[model samples]
Target: MKEALLLQVETYVVDLLNKQLAATNYYHNAIHTRRVVANIEELASLEACTEQETMALKLAAWFHDVGYIYTDQGHEEESVTIAISFLKQQEVPEDLLSLVEQLILATKSEFKPKHKLEAIIKDADCGHIASENFIEISGNLMKEINAKNHKHISEIEWLQQNLVFLKNHSFYSNSAKQLWQPKKEINQLEVQKKIDKLLAKEKKKDKSSRFGRGIETMFRVQLKNHIELSAIADTKANILLSVNAIIISVALSNLIPKLDSPSNLFLVYPTLILMLFSVASVVLSVLSTRPKISNVAITKEMIKEKKTNILFFGNFQKMSLQDFEWGIDYLMENEETLYNSLTKDLYYLGLVLNRKYKLLRITYTVFMFGIIISAAAFIYSYYVYFSV
Candidate 1:
């Protein structure tokens, strides 16, 4: 009966947490609560707690973080309140209920444990910080903090914060001190190593930016604009292509058949002229939108002279990776060369877009003139051959 009652309480806590905890509570959801419960079970065995003490500690672990669903601030007190109310509903002994409330309260990082049981529960709650998965768990904790507090923390800042936290944090239970303390120290050292590497990388980037930051930004913006204009040119070409295709289709189906009869012979030249202009327009439109591939062979000398643009695939499509990497490295090391490459890339893109638009313009002009001349020819033929 006692086992069944405890099982009921665990079920209720799991259900409540799953329902109340938002998706943004990435660290404090049901998974975390379950982990704490499992940790306490392990510690309870090692600490040699009595059966009643074990039950109370396990109950506290299950309920301890439940109040995170209600509020982020002063959640420990809310957790204690919830544990008391739930235990009362279960008709638990007053002494056992009070002990459970105390265990929940002891989980607050600021609160020092007043007894062995309290110490065990507190250490269990923080078991992940000493486990092999500390780094992954710590990342989730930071994400949860950011979501709950509406704060953004950089990787370096978070590592520094953990450094301070681990420095000050201590395991209260002898079991944790003996087993987890060494692992916790290892985690702290790894975090420090990461922080150092990140700092060095940032320093290098800052130094590199000193030489060509403005030029790089200018080139990036120009390249982006050129790409946008190229897209617009392609879209215009496609529109002309579609329009001319439809015109040719209609001329072939409807107008070409009429030319078989001598009575409709006057329509022959006009229809043929209309279809000719449309087919020509379509061919030009397709050329304007067609992707051009380079068939010319490139040599290392061209790359050395900065005449080849490694940024464009057509320029380096046939080059070996080693050669390409060497060319890229040379460009990166030389700020002037990098800027010149970007300039050439942007300039060539502009040239291509200009050609596309020029072709599209001619296509539209021919289409317009063909329609006008065809309508004039049709009207003149009708008046001369049939109107009289």
Candidate 2:
């Protein structure tokens, strides 16, 4: 009669769990409960439990997680209530029904078992921690928690938590301790290995992130410096341009008309020399400030080869916006290509600055020499005319 009652309990709990358990209860589903039943049977046989004790254990295992169909919090107490109600309807004796309730409650993670029977059921409930598929099983539990709580728990974090639980936990039954302790140690090592690998990967990723930031900073600083220098070069060219323009205007308005007179013939050469140098200075200044137009159009082939810099407008100005956007996307996806393009941009900018500064230098030199020679020529022309 007791055997038939146990079978009824199993059938009822299995059906209830199948129909009512939430999909998110990945670790505490029907399979887990069935495994617990199997574990308790093996443990009971090894410990030489009486038929009554064994029957109570199997009944408790079947009902231990049924309350999870409704909720997870305080489910052990609910499980006990369900066990009592079911066993009473079966006309079970109060003594055996009470033992079944106690055994069900003993499976609570925080509960300390009072005797060998409680110990057997509790050990069975947590048997998977020593099982060969512990990692896969633990992963499912992690997934279940994340799904139910709507939060992410990384694998490394889950493994660390498992390691702490393993270090603190031990089987209550002597039979369980003797049979499963060695395998449990091996599972601990496996968890440690996984944790170590995850830590190493995180460390490498952090280092790479820092290095990438450093590269960005370098590019930012260098590009800013290049733009500033270019602006200064343009300013210098503008100054030379204004100065030479004024000199040419003054000569054309004040000096050139006087050169037509016979008495002013000596002044003609001096004035001509000044005018020629002023015009040359003006030309050089304009050249220094002029924008360089690139005739080489950026093609799709060059962009694909990573040969052209899409960041510089001069390189891509002639291309359609569609092509330019495609090039930009390609550049962004490739780290090496993006950095290379930036480096090339800086190098070309430096070259342009070098040419501008060189031209400005030559313009300043011409203006200075023109002023000195023209002044001396005027002095000589006046002395010859007056001494005669």
Candidate 1's C-alpha runs over 4 A off are 211-388
Q: Tens digits of per-residue lDDT for model 2 on 311-333? A: 88888989999998888887765
lDDT of 1 by residue, 95-182 (tens): 9888888898898878999889999999999998887888788899899889878999987999899989899999999988988899
Which regions of candidate 2 deviate over 4 angstroms?
A: 210-388
**Which candidate number would show the highest lDDT if scored against the true structure?**
2
Quote each prediction's TM-score: 0.56, 0.55
